[model samples]
Target: MDLTNLSYEEGLKELESIIDSLETGELTLEESFNKFKKGVDLYKYLYEILNKVEGEIKIIMEDEEREEDFQLEG
Candidate 1:
């Protein structure tokens, strides 16, 4: 599966797997570094997606309390 094309949940799961692999110290240094890089990329992608969604929600319901609403102007 292509990490870049994965949904938020899928990316997170893959990132968790990468973390497990790194923590186990079973992979060669190069492999570990590659996986780590991919994990970071996935994490960033997920975070950005989440931030955008949150922003959209805030925009959509500016007046109402959004569950545990906090000011999120962006």
Candidate 2:
């Protein structure tokens, strides 16, 4: 599965499903391992997306603060 295109929510849901499957112990060992790998990949993708969003938010907040400072000066 290509996780790169998935939204954070979608990746989280898929990760949850993988956890449920592992907890159920219904899958063969190899299958479970494969699922685990996929889950890890999804997690990394989600993490990267979160980091990008955080940086964007910081930039927006800084911009707002600068605008406020300018207004006070004016």
Candidate 3:
């Protein structure tokens, strides 16, 4: 499957499948390494998306808090 083009949920599902395949001890060494690489890429992509979302939320909360403080001091 093309992990790069996958949606977040689809990428996560595919990563889980790769883990299961590796844990089964059925694939050859090369195949295992390839799956592992794909899993890592998926993980990195998900992490980046989550981090950006978190950062945006943090900025919004900080702005709200500043507004509240100004209201209190006015």
Best by TM-score: 2
lDDT, candidate 3, 10-63, per-residue tens: 877887998999999999999999989988988888887789889999999999
**Candidate 2, residue 71: how far the Cα is off, in Å:** 0.8
- Which sections of candidate 1 miss by over 4 Å? 1-4, 63-74
Candidate number with the higher TM-score (2 or 3)? 2
User: Candidate 1: what lDDT?
Assistant: 0.83
Better of 2 and 3 by lDDT: 2
Give all candidate RMSDs, comma-separated: 6.8, 0.9, 1.9
| Weakest 10 consecutive residues of candidate 1 by summed lDDT | 65-74
* Candidate 2 Cα deviation (angstroms), residue 9: 1.4
Residue 6: error of model 1 in Å?
A: 1.4
Q: Judged by TM-score relative to the true structure, which candidate is superior, 1 or 3?
A: 3
1-74: candidate 1 lDDT, tens digit per residue: 36567788887888899999999989999999899888888888889999999999888776566533655542
> Residues 1-74, candidate 2, lDDT per residue (tens digit)?
87758889999999999999999999999999999999999889989999999999999999999999999999
